[model samples]
Each structure stands twice: as structure tokens, then as C-alpha cells.
Target: MSDYDFELPDARIALRPAEPRDAARLLTSYADGRLEDRIVRDLPQILAPGDRLVVNDSRVIPARLVGERLRPAGTARVELTLLVEDEPLRWTAFAKPAKRIGEGDTLRFPVPGGVVEGRVEARTGPTVTVRFAADPLAAGAMPLPPYIAAKRAPDARDESDYQTVYADPPGSVAAPTAGLHFTDRLFSALAERGIGLSRVTLHVGAGTFLPVKTEHLNEHEMHAEWGTVSAATVAEIAATKAAGGRIVAVGTTSLRLLESAAGEGVLAPFTGDTRLFIRPGFRFHVADALLTNFHLPRSTLLMLVAAFAGLARMRAIYAHALRHDYRFYSYGDASLIFADPR
Candidate 1:
């Protein structure tokens, strides 16, 4: 635990989608926590010619499952959100109506092939274990964050909108949302302008949106996320650093992978799990800027923002956002934060 605590109002919550991908507002903050406001479409205007924008390309799988209860007659309707798929058949999930759902309880999902079945193998509070009847990846629904609840459950439309064009490796339970702003057109435009793009992969997982309940920051436990930093990306980052170009991570997921895999002293290649909980005192290894969405209050994401920008500065910026009615969360508005080495 750390002493990073703040308040965010309910009204700041964004309940809908931006009309155009880039139509949403953008807020960029300096290392010292200075803030500048701009629209997402104008991002190219503010960025320098040599800046490198790194994005996480991890694809978001459909992880939300809707099905009827099969055990104990008259079982109520249930929703199971998959947290991690161990294989084609096994998974760890967080289920609603978790009380009656226990080991061996049968669950089902709809698909053209028929019902995708599963069995609850474990249960703890709201979380549950699910052993799937088939490949969970092919049938699960996109686990959209609670704040951006959909009018209807995830469908084919989310197949494209919730994922970035560059997504490759499929592992993340949640989308690396800030990347959602970059249309192929926007990316092409930036590329044409010589604004370099880089990539890192940190599979977004269950820990990302969980609330920080403990008052003592040190007691907070971070969940491990799998990540990979390619050698080519490392070399590109080094070149960017050497040439005086800013390394702008597209999302906090990319930022975490970069910082966890590289060194404060110099960039390096890495592959492993990261439970790296970045706080105020942590020195950054990669990234000079961040493109992200506003996060839940009392969440680790907010803590990360607080660390990037000073706590007080972030507070003011967030307050301004709240006052101006900026949309918040995974499908919400975006922010461009500059990470100048302090």
C-alpha cells in the first residue's frame, strides 16, 4: 500500500459510445502533471514527427457467457464471465448468481453448433471455475466492463469495434480500449506523417478493473498478466530514445508491458508474467506518453495515472473531466498523457 486515494463522481461515467471513434475528447498530461485538453482527431497535430506510438495488439475474446441453470430444478438465469481460459475445455470465470453454482454445476451457451456446455468446478464468493464442453474461445462473449454496460449482450458488431485492427495474440479478457480510437485511417494518417508506431503485448486480465479495497497500498495484491516484448520492438524503442523521439504507449496495458519488460536504465527484450504494480515512486523503462481512458475511482488504473501524473495534478484533471462531462471507462473517451522522464 500506498497513499493514493481520490474521488470520482457517478455522473463522470460514460454510458454510451462516441459518435465517431476520434470525436471523443482527449486530455494529455505532462510528467509533472500539467494538463492540456484536445480532441482525439487532432492528436496528429500535437504529436511530433518522430514520436513512436506503441500499442498493445492483444485481441479481446468473447468471455461473457449467458445461459440457463441446469442443476437443481428451476435454477435462475445466470451469467458467467470467463477470466482465463486454461485450454479449449477448462477456464476460470466469475459468475453472477454464484451462490447456488458450485463444482459440477452445469452451464450452457448458445452458438450455431448448439449449446456450449460447462461445469462449475470451483466457487469462491463471486468467482467460479468452469470446465467447458468445447473451445471456450470460439463461443464466449466479450467481457465488456461493468461501467459501459451494453443495452444488449455482446454480438457480432463487438467482434470488430471492441478489438483493435492490429490485434493478433488472443488472450486478454478485456480490451486494450484506448487503441479503439485508432481507425486504420487514423493509423495510416499518422504513418504518413512519420509518426512511428511500436507494439507490446500484455494480455488484459481480471485484475485490471478490480477495486482497491485496502487502505494500505502495500497490502494490495496485483494479479499476474502474461506479456511479451519482442527484440525488434526493443531495438526500435532504443532507436527512438537515441534519436530523441517520444515513446507513446497506446494504452496502460502497453505501458505496463513496456515498463515491466524493459529497464529504467535501458530497453531490453523480455517474456513472462508481470505482477508489476506501478506506483508513484516507480521509474519508467519505456514510454514517454500514454493514450488511455479515464478509470474507475479507487482502481489500480487510477493509481497508475496518479503515478504518471502527480496525484494532485491528476485530481485536478479528473475534476475538470468530471465538470466537463467526459465519458469514462473502457468504451469511453480517451486521454493522451506525455511521460517526460522526471
Candidate 2:
């Protein structure tokens, strides 16, 4: 939103995740927006041995379904991205042909693999509320982001690739992408080098890609995302702070969860929802380094990067990345960012 402009070739989009997690590429940009290219495998060499690496292990759920219009009969298939569950069978959804749908209707799926039935409960402008009677995933499909172009719907294969290796206690609709770059070897190397590790969970939501539409920036209301910080992770951060160890947030989600939990320069154990929006002039209470993917232009995630690393620097970095052909978005490559010094 800050007048940052750049062009990215569609050819640079990464269709699939990099193999051997740690084998993915990495971009390191300076506070001044200088660029450096390296392999993800070099993380151990890039970061200091004692720095704490905090990661979000929230796994993505199979939240997309293909259903059919009931009243119209033989109508085109409707694709629904289940947003948030309100009750046991009740959910808020982003339904396609959003034009043809209305309140108090039912949707049927001809999909052979997953759950096939649901009744529309309500309609609030863009969202179709549905109380699912079937386990859609069993009959439904996994929903990929709007960025990743695909021919067919989600299948059993997506059940695996759409998740991270450390994903446990599944709830997120999107993967904590930074974790995608870590395999056992990467962890082992970090451990062998005495690099510290910590865990935090932020159930990423569909709002992750929601663009910043407000100019004041402060007026942009961030959707609250549920997060949890275990005692162990809190202890790690506390000890790191006590020992003067810097906190290296594995992803923006983890960074947000940690900063949300930190109120008075000390991190407390937390388990709840947070809508802490980071923008220009907002002081970061915790986290020193961030490992994140290249985000979409004019997106909230991009604003977060701009907030963490100066806005001008981030724009320059994005421009540099675009020029250097760095992959962009969810399935793309990653960058290691340091918090900006104001």
C-alpha cells in the first residue's frame, strides 16, 4: 500500500515444495535491502550457534470441499473453502458461484472420495454458512491457496504434501510454510551446533492473505488467530532472554504469537486468540530474526515484513528478489529477515 511497485514473472512461481526440506533456496537481505542468495542448508552456518529458533508446528487441515447446487439441478459444481467451524457441523465457508447461493439451502456433492452433503444455514454477504452432515474431507478435497494453480481438486496425495513434518495437533487451514524447509537433518545440524529450539502454535487462517485495504494501516482490523505457547516454549524464551540469546522466529506466525504473548518484555505462557497487528511505528517487544517466505505484493504479510525490516528496505528487497527471479508466495522459496533498527 505504500507505493511499492514491482513485476514478477509467472514462471518464477514454485508449483511444488522443494525436496529434502533443507534443500530449498534462501534469500538473505540486509537492512539496507542488499541481497544474498544461498541454499536453505546453509542456515546452520548463517545463524549463530546459541540463537533460539522458534517455530509454529500448526498443521493444515483438509478444509476444501466440492458440492453441487441443490435447487437448480445439474448446476455447475460449487467449490467451498470452509473458513471457521462455529459448532459441530456448523461452519463459515467461502463458497463459489457465491452469486447463486442463498440462505436455507442444501449442497450435494457427486465427489466419489469424500463427504457429500451439507445444508446451507445462512448467508452473510460473501460467506455461506453450512452445517455439514458429512465429513467432507472423506468425500471432499483439500483446498490449495488461490496462488497455486491446479487442474483437479485435492486428493489423498494432498493429505501429505499440504502438511509439515512437525505438524501436530492439526487445526490450521494453511501450512506454517517456514517449517517446510526443515527435515530431520536440518534439526539435527541445529542441535549438533547447539542452536536452541522452541515451539509455538498459531492456527493460520484464510485471512493470512487478506490484503491491507486501509490507508491509515492502524485502522485495518486483523482477524484474530488462535495460538498457544506451552510452558516449555516459554521457558526456552525466558532462558534465552536471561542468557542474552537472540530469538529467531521461524515464521511470521510464530513471531506474531510470541509478541502477542509478550506484554512487559517478558513472555508469559499463553493459550488464546490474538489480533495483534504489526505496522509501521509499532515496536516489536520480542523476536530478533525471522525466517519467512516471499509474500504477495500489497498483502498483510508483506506489511508485516515491512514492519519487521524497514518498509523501504523490504520494498527494495522485494524488487531485488523479483529481479533475481526469487520464487514468490506459499509454495515459493524463503528469506531470512532480521528485525529493523529504527
Task: Output the number of the lDDT-best candidate.
Answer: 1
Clashing pairs in 2: 114-138, 114-139, 114-140, 115-138, 115-139
Per-residue lDDT of 323 in model 1: 75
TM-score computed on alpha carbons, candidate 1? 0.92
TM per model?
0.92, 0.93
Q: Please, what are the lDDT tens digits per residue for candidate 1 over residues 48-165?
A: 8888999999988787777776865666688877777666678888788788687778887777768888888888888887887787656667787766554455666677778888
* Model 2 TM-score, 2 decimals: 0.93
- How far residue 126's Cα lies from its native spot in candidate 2, in Å, is 1.8
